[model samples]
Target: MAIYSSTSPKFFLSSASTSTTSTTAMSTTKKLKRYLELDSSLEDEIPSKKKQQLPRRTCLVCDVEKGTNQFPNHKKVSSHEHDHNVCDPCYRSHLENEIDSKGWNEVACPECSITLTYKEVKNMTTAENFAKYEQACIRATLAADPDFRYCLSTTCKSGQLHPGGTDEPIFRCEHCGHKHCIVCEANWHQDQTCEEFQAVRRRLHAENERSQQEVKKLSKPCPGCRVPIQKNRGCDHMRCSRCRHEFCWVCSADHGLIFREGNHRHEKNCIHYRANPRAQEPELPRHRIERMLEPDTRLRAYNRGDLDDSDFDGSDSDDSDLDDTEPWDDEADLPLVYEPDLILSEVRRRAPGQTLSRVYVG
Candidate 1:
């Protein structure tokens, strides 16, 4: 501090300025040289335009070959190495299946935002399983899918896409343990490992297993007919295919009692049996029907035109003005009786009070 006082402030300032200028020049020179070296390195790495473009690997899913530049990276399992030409759909499907079987609900493509199941990932065939990372790069032009545009997130349920990236876009659902992709709103990416997510996946696996068991239980065919069995109610009554004898589906034993009307149970010991009630003979309806005959019913004399207008009206109640027309003589030769029993009768075997009746005219 005392040394600065011995020197003129202007002189010191000038000297310091000169030193600063030199340092700036040196720094600038160094930066320029560094930039030149980087440029040279970059040029060396890239091939000339005249160089032939490498052929793209074929995608395994869609079976389309794409350029190498389109691929993101390749992959390998253990010591074995193989080309991953699989398309995005096939890969996503494979991953998804694997994840699901392990109980993972959602799996995102490591490269793309596509969602997949755990089963899809692990069950990949030997060919798909052995793809090299570079060859399997999902970014490859072959990975494009035009049909699928929606995000794969199970929780999002939002079907549309946004123009801009997500705000607070990259979020992990603490409840579901799913990672949401900003662009697609699809869940699959992971910024960090989550124990909660794994637990959720395991729970899903258990639930799936339970579902499969339930399906198996419901899929049993009827022992009697070899047809699919369905439980109408909790009773064990069942019938046969060709015979349809009332017996328990679990044990082929006769139902204890004869069938009554309106009982739902078909158990072996069930009181509900009637030689295959569905095979019962159809019955006709019953009602008494009688025909009445009037002596002058259709005679033309009954016609109002046969009488004078005064006779037809109340002003002329005299029957003397009426015309006496003879009935057709051919009627004498016609049979006096019409068809008999127009009203059908049906007896009730189940309930005596439930006899059905039908009325008819001929």
Candidate 2:
């Protein structure tokens, strides 16, 4: 026999490790099996039980569908109490006072394929039940009536279950050509999977796309002036000050009144002045007068240094004759008029009618 040491540390350690691993593996396996069983049992039992317990529904006003074990049980009338299964709500609905109101007609429940009169639905035993029955009848009738329905989407046509847990809807508006999901009564487009509320959304989108394409295809010049034509690129409206043109973004045609004409003159003036400073000049002097009548005599009279009173002696007859016969070339054209004295007395003696020429002459 091989020599075996009972107290060897290596053997003891190996044994302990194997035991721990085996225990762990066994526990893990057991936990896994338990989980599998739980999953299978839930799948098999719970859903089936749920389905069995779910309420069976039948239209109260019509003979459409009848589901069992549903809540909101209806009681039969006293006349038909023996028949507990009878839908009393449906029976009482046949005697409404408004049967004649608005030409009440007999409408069939589309869901149950049973004819239900409006008078029957309106005559529910209780007000609350009557309202409920009436609503159900309306839904059924609307679903069956082609006039009230639109077309079904492909998804609905293919019978895809709605996310809402109810029976799928089958009714749609005939005019709009829209279909509502059976479960949620939610409408969806034929091409898309998402639920939509408005039927016009797709149409509106197409119209908008068409409009954008038309706008893009159009090639008109800037309405403000005959420049480049980039429609709706920046602004819709433009104002041209050069030609006073006003127009939409596309057209380059001469559109007047975009800018006012009155200010062009001022603007031109300003520009001209800015470019050529000399364009703006001041006015000429306005006060100079011509001294043409008296010439040298007036000049000599005004010039104090030229002559004195000796030139005009009052009593000198010889000087007087000389003055009258003077050979003055400058005064030759002037009339012969003279005074002997050249002082204030002479001016005082002159008549009021005497002008500057006459006064100086005298």
Candidate 3:
């Protein structure tokens, strides 16, 4: 019997593989031989390496090695320490996204704070995107100019530089067709000069200040709810709005128990306890303080027939007599009421309407 060791199977397998390869080896060998011979036939085939393609660079953005042909058309993004480049695809996407969100301001590198100028970015992006960027640049440039102004109307979004500026205050917005004052920056004040309008505004502002002071002086805060309550035409006894808690208007002491128990007992220190609040203090409308703050205007109001006897005390309408509430004598109270009819009648009754001339008050 033949010796059958473990190595006998391996020997048989190797011999079978060698026989199979020998048949195919000649065809592969002949092709290689012809290639070498044809290339070297005319001159010695240069001992050379494979043709080198474009140098690959690692992209700063995607961190992928890409050929130089796949870079953006612009120069390197950063000049300083951050000297790296982004791939073409990543660079385009970043530029478009920035233009959409932040506009063409400081478009920095993808991986660093090295910002590029707007012009540099413009050269790298598509034509459509460049148009939008150019538009934004134009808007920014126009906005920086001081002469160019936007229409103040909320409904209109148009503006132009006025040829005569504040020298011609009345500016009619062409878009909205509403006239406004460029100097005052307000709606056109018809039939009044700008100075007159400004004087009226100042007078109104003073009146408002006086009115606020009068309200603060007259109105008292509810102790229970802490809400300001004005007893314009009510008794000293008051009630809160939402809480409905009865309290004293003058002293703000709780009066819930008195109302509930039917006994109107008040704190002895309160003004209501001593005397009737209505009788102690005169019932004057709080706005009279605002109307009378301009003491000079009081005499003018009386002379203009705007002040009525019932509206104020019968005292002389003079700055010196503001504190004097004493009633005037009968003759003084009836002193020539300045009526327009009386003014015309006095002029005519001078000689009983012989002839009349139109008199205008400027």
Candidate 4:
């Protein structure tokens, strides 16, 4: 392209350069006219100093009217809609409260029951807090596995799932080189059976009356897992350190979220619980309701003894009334304690090329 230039490169100015010089001259003329106040045409073109700011919303949290930007993540996202009700400060304070309570695992919006997604949680929290949440999640996931166990050593805080839990009782902690008896989930028993260890423990317990009295005075058994928990100094809302079971220290009742008048988090027997006559189930979206009927979810519920024949009656469900007596084409409705289908599914997962029907969730 450069071989066909008729004029020498230095002698000829580019068309772009000529256009730029003319544009600069015109801009200078406009500025001079503006300064002289000779032209009123540009007066309307100049933007006004005061902007007509609107779309301000009242924060449901503080009842203070603030700008749209004050709301945290106030946009139509996959997890939630544009929430203009809660301000950024209030929303962040809510997150901090949840984090401090050690309930950052399943933090829901203050406005709704919709759980915060992983990315949302990360964005709202500090890196340290986010890492803690990640560790909590890992612990919870491991806790779901029957073979998982924490190391017995006092100094070591590591835990992992030991394969063949029922078959092999010896669980050696790879983190601290500590050995533990899987059957009893206690310190390693050297040259002794579990029964023998229990007998010895019983005898030792009988001899130590002072320790037992002190324990009885300070600690109480968690209704969920029967693990003994001590309350040093805090509110009646006690959460078991071992099982993570929330319960009232006074009544030793399960600390489930109660939607009653006084906003109770304990059983009716407990003083903290206050019943509301008009209280009913909090309404969720139809999609969320339908998602509960997924195969794997239903199966897990069945395994945990949370489902019954009545739960399968989708026809009676409010808003949905779905005719899904058989919710999924899987063994979700099966009531067997030990399922062979799980083993078969594991086999299929290991060997992907196999043509056999695998037990999969919807």
In order, what lDDT does every prediction score?
0.46, 0.44, 0.64, 0.66
Best by lDDT: 4
TM-score of 4: 0.43
Candidate 4 residue 89 C-alpha distance from true site, Å: 2.5
lDDT value for model 3: 0.64
Question: Which candidate number maximizes TM-score?
Answer: 4
Count of clashing residue pairs in every prediction: 45, 14, 0, 0
Tell me model 1's lDDT, rounded to 2 decimals. Answer: 0.46
- The C-alpha stretches of model 4 lying farther than 4 A from their native spots are 1-51, 73-77, 102-105, 210-362
Q: After best superposition, candidate 2 residue 32: deviation in angstroms?
A: 4.8
lDDT of 2 at 131: 68
Query: Mind giving the per-residue lDDT tens digits that candidate 2 earns over 1-362?
Result: 12457687342346667788899999999999999999999899988998887765655446555545321233312222122232444544433333323222444322232444444344334676456556655555665643343346653322222332333345544445556654344564465444453446668889999987876577554544555444445654555555455654433323243232222223333321122112233221111011123344534543544445655433222223222133333334334333223222333333235444433342
Superposition error at 31 for model 1 (Å): 6.6
Q: Which pairs clash (backbone N, Cα, C closer than 3 Å) in model 3?
A: none
**Per-prediction TM-score:** 0.23, 0.17, 0.35, 0.43
**Model 4, range 1-362, lDDT digits (tens) per residue?**
11335675445557878888899999999999778674564565453322235367899889998877667763322578756488877877776667667555667777886778777877766677678777777788888888788998989999887999758989888898998888887888899999999999988988798788988887888888888888888788887777788877877765565422233445668777654422433333343323333445445655665666566554332323333334432243343232343334344445557554324332
Candidate no. 1 TM-score: 0.23
Ranked by TM-score, the better of candidates 1 and 2 is 1
* TM-score of decoy 3: 0.35
